[model samples]
Structure formats: C-alpha cells, structure tokens
Target: MEKNTILEQLRAAKAAHINWVQRAKMLISGFKMEEDAIPVNSTQCKFGQWFYSDAQRLNGLRNNPLDCMSEIEKLHFELHDIYLNIYKIYYDLEPQGFFSKLFGKKKKITDDSVKLAKEYFASMEEVSKKLVNEINLMERRIVALPDTDLETL
Candidate 1:
C-alpha cells in the first residue's frame, strides 16, 4: 500500500478508537452513577447489572478494531493489555442472565463489586489516554518518515 493510503487508514482507525473510548467512558460513568443511586440489594439493581453486562460486552467488542490497527502497525499497544484486564474484571463481575435470575441464582452486588467497578472505570480511562498517546506517536513517526522511505514501504 502507498504511504499516504496507509497513513489515512491509520488516522481513521485512530479516530474510531478515540470515539469508542469516549463512548465507553460515558457508559461507565453513567452506569456508575446509576448503580450508586440504587440500593445494592434492591430488585431494581438487577437492571443495573444487566446494563453492566452489556457495557462489558460492548467494551470487549471495541477492543478488536484497535487490535487490528495495532497488528497492522506492528505495535503492541498498552491499551490492548489494559482492555484484557478490563475484560477479566468484567468476567469476574458477570451478571446473571434471565434464566439465572429466574432460577434465583442472581449474584449479590456488594460494596466490593462497586469498588471494583470504579477501578475498572479508572483502568479504562488510563487505556484511553495511553491509546491517544500511542496514536499520536504513530502519526508523528509516519509524518516524519522521508518520502523515499515511505515509498519503499
């Protein structure tokens, strides 16, 4: 591929990733606030759990596009590792599905779970910042490359 074409693709990926991270942050923040508003033991809390599960799934899905970009650029970004960590935390906090709730197997959302959620949100924010930095560095490198070297690639 031509250098300019590759750079354009990278820029697009960067924009998409940034937007994804921003949306994720908004979801997490909204969920956190909502979760805090409801009593942990209330039946209504189940809805929050469901929302969290969906958010986790969404976050997991978002990681793939960024990973593709990372692979294409031959760079292993810290965001990828952080996303894995976030996934693990979500897995640990996985909410009971409809059948599980119907069967009375709902997991209790304790204060510890709330703390963990906050930690997860912080980790996600960190990943977002790191990803922005990494993308900026990648863009700088691409821009700095000589025309001769760019053409060779």
Candidate 2:
C-alpha cells in the first residue's frame, strides 16, 4: 500500500477508536447518572455481553493465518491493534462498569478517557486529512501516466 493510503487507513481507524471512546463515556455516564441505566430487563442491556461479543469477533478474525490474509484483513488487524493500544493508553480513565460502582462513590473513568482520546483524535485528524489530500494528489499523477498498449506485450 502507498504511504498516504496507509496514513489514511490509520486516520480512519483512529477516528473510529476515538468515536468508541466517546460512546463508552456516554454509556458509563448513563450508567452512573441513571438509577438503572443497565438493568437486567434484557440480555441486550448487559454491557459485558456487548464487550465480549466485540472482543470475540476481533480476536477471531485477527488470529487468522498470515498467508491467507488479504489487504482488508491486514487493515482490520492494523485498526484493531490501534484501538487496543489506545484503549490501554486511556484504560485507567474508565471506571469499572459495575452497577455498584456506577451508583456509588466511584468516579467515571470512561468519561475521562473519552476526554483525553478526543484531544488525541483531534490532533491525529489533522494528519489524516493531510494524508488524504496527498493520496488524492498521487492518484492524479497515476491517472496522468501514459497508457500502455497491452497488445504490444
């Protein structure tokens, strides 16, 4: 892949990671402010279920044989790795997602992580936009190249 394309991919993946960080914060806040934001009313309301599901899907696809991996697969792995790394970077900011903690004296770590992640993303977003512009310029150059005659080969 081209350097600009790779940068674009990184930007997109980072944006997504940043988005999730915000979402996690919102969920955590809801869990905290509400008396029962995540009640046992249904399996869908269980945060653990969604976390496990996401983690499972990510791990399963990421562990595939290297030889069999396609560009998209590699991108997925790269994106997943970026997210995992960012999560660790701000993981300490998130509070334990437990009902007792949410309603009790515990502060929300998710909110804190999201705040920091947003700043990180904002800076990276500028780089991503620049990369996209670079990729577009490169594509224009490729398009301007002379067409080869396949029949002459």
Clash tally, candidates in order: 0, 4
Residue 140's lDDT in candidate 1: 69
lDDT of 2 at 77: 35
lDDT of 2 by residue, 67-141 (tens): 222333333333334434334543333556677565655433566676665555454445434533543453344
How many clashing residue pairs are found in candidate 1?
Answer: 0
As a TM-score, model 1 comes out at: 0.48
Candidate 2 weakest lDDT stretch, 10 residues: 38-47
What lDDT is obtained when candidate 1 is compared to the true structure? 0.46
Model 2 scores what on Cα lDDT?
A: 0.39
lDDT for every model? 0.46, 0.39
